[model samples]
Target: ATGGRYVPRAILMDLEPGTMDSVRAGPFGQLFRPDNFVFGQSGAGNNWAKGHYTEGAELIDSVLDVVRKEAEGCDCLQGFQMCHSLGGGTGSGMGTLLISKVREEYPDRIMETFSVIPSPKVSDTVVEPYNAVLSFHQLVENADECFLLDNEALYDICFRTLKLTTPTYGDLNHLVSAAMSGVTTCLRFPGQLNCDLRKIAVNLVPFPRLH
Candidate 1:
């Protein structure tokens, strides 16, 4: 995943091979452990087919190894929460492929994703529409609660609210992290009604694929 441009490695300051005082100074640093990440040697070239069929297949085993290790350590494993973009090859194709593979092992577990959908106005490549739709099809079958994030909406927020002339991926990710933190707050803190993933899923998703 670090092969992709958007993944914020600094969030997990502890995972880095070399320590950075500036990154560790941040409030949300060291959120992830060193074993929580897997990286590919190369990118998927912004193509869905290349990601899912080629690159994803190559990395699937390694990714699953990490998942199995993490799952083993959990006493009461709830589910998985993934954050990726539907417009990019790695996030869209590889992301869906990985989720599907994980589903084969943990079929009953809930799978939720913060998926960044493609936008016509702000796209990274010419085939983003194709990538998004193709990835969406796989997600429809594999994921349970797919929280869609439209790039155009994020762009609008950056343009109008944040007053940014040219917004970078870091800016957009900050907004997304805020939303993600809100949704996952109940699980992380006390005194919340829906304090678990299963409860939130039951309350928010009444029907299959309604997300």
Candidate 2:
């Protein structure tokens, strides 16, 4: 039913320029044009500070330009839906930076973020806690709503609900994608309620930091 609206345009960002190629080769890559992608000099190597202070700042203009173009295309821009991992360098640091910029540029617009928090049981990096903490502060301060995805919970779901003895990263990602699809289904298709971003915010966000 299209939810009485058009599909929103997207802009993808990455810290490593080379990674864009692989992303473009993915199944749904056709949905994103080359011009809609922005990249930094290199990967953040799990360093939050480096990604935030260096790579993120360097690509801010390009990112904003893409956002501006996308916003212009919309009849009435609903909001931004940012999906990123809180434990990684680019996702944590650059995601925070982008959220801050979006808030500054579009103060009246609703900004919702889907942040993936690292699992404590199978954490690969020692500095994940620091990255998660700092990025969370930005999510709380800048984003109108933040949906947290815990890796541990996701893993358990894969192991138990899916009945997988050893679930791969792809399995966990599928769960995440499914969850996102469910949350966004009301907006993507006709629904009795919560069919718009603002309505979703009104229903979910009771306070500034509650979401």
Candidate 3:
């Protein structure tokens, strides 16, 4: 059904240079052009305020430029899908800011997010809970629908099912990607339900704030 129509024209942004290493050298590097990447030249340093206010503020205009360009290229832009982690400073703070900005520009478009929230059992940093709480507030206001993934639950799957002694970020990411692919199956394939993102949102989200 897709015939390459569903091949997303995406722009990836990261505050830290090291974080984008995989994107430049990974197996899927060919999927993206050099212009599709944006780097802030500095890290958020696990501080939500730094990400939201300083680095995010400085980089947002350039980010929006790319976003507008992509949207203009699309024949019929359905919506935006942002994937980020609520526990990390850049992913949480900058991600929240970006979604809000996107919402302001594209008021009628569906703003969906693949959010990875912090968990007590698999804690990474001390202030992860605080970052997540703050990020959640913005997501509630900006995002139309959120697909949340718990860090602890994913860890459990890696431990029990994959039998990995120490599961890497790549393993967890693969799991998340697999789940996303499953969710969007109806969008790309012929089916009885044949649901789009809006239809899925209609059925799943009974109330606007609940998502």
Report the lDDT of model 2 for residue 135.
Answer: 91
The model with the greater lDDT, 1 or 3, is 3
Each candidate structure's TM-score, on Cα atoms with residue i matched to residue i, is 0.81, 0.92, 0.92
Clashing pairs in 3: none
Residues 38-146 of candidate 1 have per-residue lDDT tens digits of: 6665678888887889877887787788788778867888889887888878888888888899899999898889998888887779988899889878888988888
Location of the lowest summed lDDT over 10 successive residues in candidate 3:
1-10
What is candidate 3's lDDT per residue for 41-137, written digit by digit as tens?
A: 8878888888899998899899999999989988888899899998888999899999989999999999989999999888889999999999999
Best by lDDT: 3
**Global CA lDDT of candidate 2, please?**
0.86
- Quantify all predictions' global Cα lDDT against the true fold: 0.77, 0.86, 0.87
TM-score for candidate 1, residues paired by index: 0.81
Model 1 steric clash total: 0
Q: Please, what are the lDDT tens digits per residue for candidate 2 over residues 74-125?
A: 7988889999998989999988998999899999898988898988897989
